[model samples]
Target: MTALDTEVAQSVGDIRESYLAQVGRRRLYSGLALLIFVVLMVSGFNIADERNAGGFWEGLHQIGDYPGEVLTEAWQKRADLPGLISEFFPALVETVNIAAVSTIIGAVGGLILSLLGTRGLAKWPRLIPLFRRVSDILRAVPEIVIALVLIFILGGGPVPAMIAIALHTAGALAKMFSEVAENADLKPVQGLASTGATWTQRMMLGVLPQVAPNYVSYTLLRFEINIRASAILGFVGAGGLGYELRNAMAWGPGRFDEAAAIFILLFSTIVFFDQVSSRYRNRLTEGQAQ
Candidate 1:
């Protein structure tokens, strides 16, 4: 080979070596990460098993016992199922109402937080980190923890559950909304700005229109989640179907029929909302694609 050809060949060899080195490093990092993940999982499971009241392995075999008992009792009391459902229907409605109210409030709060935290759309760019951290804190806290605290202060009711779910929903939705908002086209915002529109005006007229479908879709999903959360909160004294379920279960074998009815109502409501939300989300996704 000529000198020039040798130089080019050497450069090619260097590039190939560098690429192989990078790939080797990536593989090493990935292996370490997998090892750490496995360690954490094993250790966490062991710790939980040790601390769990009934022990994980011991309880594992008996997990189906309660369900079997509930089912048997429910079947024997089949005639009372209709009456029990009717009696608990109002509580079910209360649970749904709590979810609905929380979702609306949360959606509105999430929109504001998303706008303020998103990089390009922020009203005060310098405060982006602040808003983001606030969202993070809200999302990081469990709904049950918040509900318990609020129940203590608010004296137990749908109100505590509603507030707890709303706070968590706002934070969760803000993260999703910010992601969607980040992808929004800036041209509309710029146009509005040039026309002397205020920040709120630009957001409402320009950015919001673009992200509204996604926002609504997220809200619907949150609503479904909040329904379950509200029910759970009810068990902790926030009155609703969950509270009724808790009371029924507390009464033991004799009240399994009541528990069964509440379970059925909760499950049916969840399935119904899931279907409704999924349909709307699919439509929104299709519209966005168009």
Candidate 2:
């Protein structure tokens, strides 16, 4: 080969080797990162298990024991099951109401926060960062913490749980809503402004129409989650099926049937909502696509 051709061939071979070396280094780094992540996860799990009231292996066999006992007692007193469900129906209603009210309140609050925080949609663009920080603080605080604190102050009832869940929902939904708002078309907003529309008018007529479906989908999903949270808060004296369940457990062996009834009610309610929410969410997304 000519000298220039030979030189070009050598240069290409060097470049190919360098590229392979870089790929090998990246693979090595990725492997190391994955290994470290696995190690941390395993160690964290071990530490948590050590601190738990029951050991994992010891508890594994007994996991089915309580359910089996509950089932046996429930089956023997099957005739009374419907009556028990009827008795506790009001508590179930209270739980659902708490979830529904909280979801509505939170959705409204979140909508305001989202509009305030989102770029190009904010009423006051300069205060966008402040609104975002407020949302962050709200989201960071757990629902249980707020519920427990409110329980101490307001006395244990559905109100405390409802407020707690609403606060959390507002923060959580704020972030999601802001993300949706950020992508909203600004042309309608500009057109409305040209007609001397106020901020509320622009948002209600221009922005909300575009994002309403997704917002409703998110709110429905939140309602499902809030139902569970309200029930759990009830265990801590908020007054719902969980309160009844706690009472039944406190009564020991004789009240296993009552506990079983509560279990069935809670499980059925959760499953029903899950199915309904999933169906509605699917329809909303499909509608949005069309």
Candidate 3:
């Protein structure tokens, strides 16, 4: 064969070899991943078995006793609906209150933070990093940890939980609000600024309108998360269904029915709200189309 033909054949062989190498690499990665997963499953089950000393299997054998009542058992038999709605619902209201109040507080705090975060607003330059860092620190802490600490100082109940959720919410909300402020149509803000509009006025007239729907959507979304958070806080004596859930589980099988019942109710309510929120979201975006 000519030198050109030899070179062409060599190039084809190189391409084939490269393709095989890539296929080999992918297969090797897949095999390693499967091995790691199998090891994890085996180890996890062994650890679980050691801890339970076969108690888990024993409990499963007795599943017939805890038949249906999902809500009570899930929340744990810590509360029945009559007792729950009458006594704990108020605490539930308190949780919702905390979420609402915190959201508002965070919204306001975030507005100020947003101003500092935005380059145009943070014209002073030195304040930008300061504001960003402050929010970073605030956002870095998890809400649950914050609540745990606050419970130590403030002495349990919804107050500490509220403070914790609020702090975290503010950090997150402010960061989002600031980012939104930064990215809004600058033309509207510029137009307002030219008309001697105050910063608040410009935000209200220009920025807010542009971002209101998104803000509302996020708020409702957080409310859903807060419901779950509040439920968990109950486990720590924050006073809600979660407290009952822990109690039921602590009491063992007999209480499982009640805990399951509460879960059914709690989850059902959350599902209802989610449906409502989804409808509202769809309605809001109706004009925009999918």
Q: Estimate each model's TM-score.
A: 0.88, 0.95, 0.74
lDDT of 2 by residue, 1-290 (tens): 69999899999999999999999999999999999999999999899999999999899999999989998999999999999999999999999999999999999999999999999999999999999999998899988899999989999889999999899999999999999999999999999999999999999999999999999999999999989988998898888888899999998888899999999999999999999999999999999999
* Candidate 3 lDDT by residue in tens digits, 68-159: 44434545544354564454455456656666676667666766776777777654567888888888877788878988888888887777
Per-candidate total of colliding backbone pairs: 0, 0, 24
Candidate 1 lDDT tens digits, 167-278: 9999999999999999999999999999999999999999988989989999998998999999999998999999999999999999999999999999999999999999
Give the Cα lDDT of each candidate.
Answer: 0.95, 0.93, 0.73
Off by over 4 Å in 3: 1-6, 37-41, 44-88, 118-125, 175-183, 243-264, 285-290
Model 3's number of clashes is 24
**Candidate 1 local accuracy as lDDT?**
0.95
Displacement of residue 271 (Cα, Å) in model 2 is 1.1
Best by TM-score: 2
Error of 1 at 11 (Å): 11
